[model samples]
Target: MSPLADRYGRRFPYLRLSVIPACNFRCTYCLPQGYHANPNAAQALTLDEIARLLRGFTVMGMHKLRITGGEPSVRHDLTYILRTAAAVPGVTKLAMTTNGSLLTRRLHEWMDAGLNAINVSVDSLDRAKFARITGHDRLDDILHGVDLALDAQMPSVKLNAVLLRDVNDNELPAWLEYLRERRVGVRFIELMQTGDNLPFFRDHHVRATALETQLLEGGWQALARVADAGPAREYRHPDYAGRIGIIAPYSKDFCSGCNRLRVTATGDLRLCLFGDFGIPLRQFLQADDQIEDLVHAIGRQIDRKEQGHFLHEGRTGITPHLASTGG
Candidate 1:
C-alpha cells in the first residue's frame, strides 16, 4: 500500500485515536467549566470497530498509533484496545497519552498489553495549584503513576506540561529540577486557541520562545536536535540527564513537518487540529465490506488537509473540544 500523504507532500505515519471523550478532570485549559460530553457519545466506536479502523490505517502505512482521550485510562476496555492495536500487522509502535491519575494501578497491565510509549499530562507539581488547575486533588496519584512508568522501563515516558502564563508558568524552574532528578523527558507545550479555550488561551498562552529564552538565561544549553516524529524542539542541560522540549504550536507553527492524523471517538478522521472538517469512518466500519472505500475516503480527507493551521492568523475554526479530538 502507498503511504498516506497530504497535498503538501507530507506523509502521515502517526495516528492519534481518541477512544473516549468523557474525562474525570476539568482542567481549565482542556476541559473548562461547563464542558459536556458530545451529544453523540452513544455513537462512540466499539472495540471491534476501533480494531478494524486500526487495521485499515495500518494497511495504509500508519506505523505508529497513539491512543488518546479525555482520559484513555478511564475507558473500561483500555487493555483490550491496547492489545488489539498493538497486534495490528503494520503497527510498529503503540503509545498512549493520559492524565496519569489512574496509571499507578494499571501501568503494568498496559505494559503487558504491548504499550511502548507513554505521555502523561501533568500541568503543575504543586499540590494545591494542581488541584486548582485540574479541579481534582489527585497529584499524588499521578506522581505515583509517573514513578511506576519509570520503574517499568518503558521505551519512552514523557511528561507533557502545557505552559499557561501566570498559571503554571511560575513552576517551570521547579518542574525542570524535579524532572532532572527523575531523568524524565519533559515537554512544555504552548497553549493553543483551538476549541472553546479561546478565552482562557488569550489570558494564559505563553510563547515557547519566551520559555526557551528563560531556560537559556538560567544556564540551560541548547543541545543537538533530536530526531523525533513530533513537533517539539528539544533542548538539554549539561547538568541534567533529562531532556526538555518546547512545542510552540501557535507561536512557532511546525505544520510544515506535520506527520499525524487524528480520529475522534465517534470515528471521524480529522485532517487538522484547528480545522473543523472531517470524514466519518463509522458507517464504513459498520458495514465492514468496503475496505477499499475506507481507504479512498481516508485519502480524500488527506487531500483536503490544509497547508497548516490558522491560529497565528486569529482564525480558529469551530473545532471540537480538546477532549473529543484527543488533543
Candidate 2:
C-alpha cells in the first residue's frame, strides 16, 4: 500500500474528480455556447461508482478530494456525492469548485453534506464585463452568494478569475479593494491555450507573472506552501484581510510540484491536465469488489506518467477546453 507516486518521485495526495462535464455557463474562454450533451459520450458516473472511486483514491494515500464538474451544481446528486466522500475514512479535506451561479441556493446543502472548502469562478467583478465573458447576467447574484458563503463561516471561500488580456486584466485595483474587507482568497489564473481557444487565447490570455509583479509592487509577500497544496502560489498583504493566489501555468518549472491527479466524469484516470491519453476506469468501477483491479490499473498506468506536460510546446493533447477535465 505505497503512496501514489509517479516515476519522477512526486507523490499525489490530491485528486480532482469531475462529477459531470455539462455546464450551463457559456464562459467565452471555455464553453462559449454553453454545454451540449454528446450523444456518444459515456453517462456520468453514478453515485455508487463515485463512492467506489473515492475509496480507491483514499486507499492510495489521497487525503484531499475535490468534486469538480463542468459545474458541480448542475448535478442533482452532488450533495449525496459530498456526503459519500466525507464518509470515506482517509479523506481529510472535502472541497468543490463551482460557477457560483447556484451557490445562493445550494451552499448550505453542500455544507451540511460535509463540504468544508469551496472555490467559485468569478472571472470579473464588473457586472457587465462578467456578463460579456460568461454570457450570464448573474454577477450580482454570484457576488451575493460569495457574501453568504463568508457569513456562514465556510472554511474556505476562494474565487477563481481566468485573467484575460484586454478583458478583466486591469481590474486588480478593484479586486484588492474587495479583498481588503473580506477573508476570501481571490486567485487570478492565467488563461491557458486550449485546442479550441487558440484564437481566443491569443486575444485574451494574461501571463500570471505580470499579475505577480503587480502584487509584489503593492507590498504583497509570498507565503510558504505545504506539500499537498494546489498549484497556486499564494501571497498575503498586511493591509488586506484576504489573500491573493497566482496560478501561473506557464511559469518556469510550474509542473515540478505537481501533486494532484484528475479523473474525467466518465471514469477515465487522466494523469495530467493536458495528458495525451486516459486509462479507462469505468470497467472496474462497475462492481464493489472491483476496487483492487481499479487500484492496480491505476498503478500500472501512472508508472508511464511523463515528467511534465508539453503545454509549452503548444500541444494540449485531448483537452479542448478547461471544462473537459474540471480545470
RMSD for each of the candidates: 1.9, 0.9
lDDT per residue for candidate 2 within 1-327, as digits (tens), equals 999999889999999999999998999999998888889998999989988998898889999999998998898988899998999889988999999988999889999999999999999999999999999999999999999999999998999999998889999999999999999999989989888989998888778887888889989999999988889999999999999999998999888999999999999999999988988999988899999998998888887788888888999989988889999
Lowest summed lDDT over 10 consecutive residues: which window, candidate 1? 222-231
Model 1 TM: 0.94
Clashes of 1: 0
Measured with C-alpha atoms, the lDDT of residue 172 in candidate 1 is: 75
Cα lDDT listed for each candidate: 0.83, 0.92
Misplaced by over 4 Å in model 1 are 39-41, 217-228, 287-289
TM-score of each: 0.94, 0.98
Q: After superposition, how far is residue 282 of candidate 2 from its true place, in Å?
A: 1.0
Angstrom error of the Cα, residue 112, model 2: value is 0.3
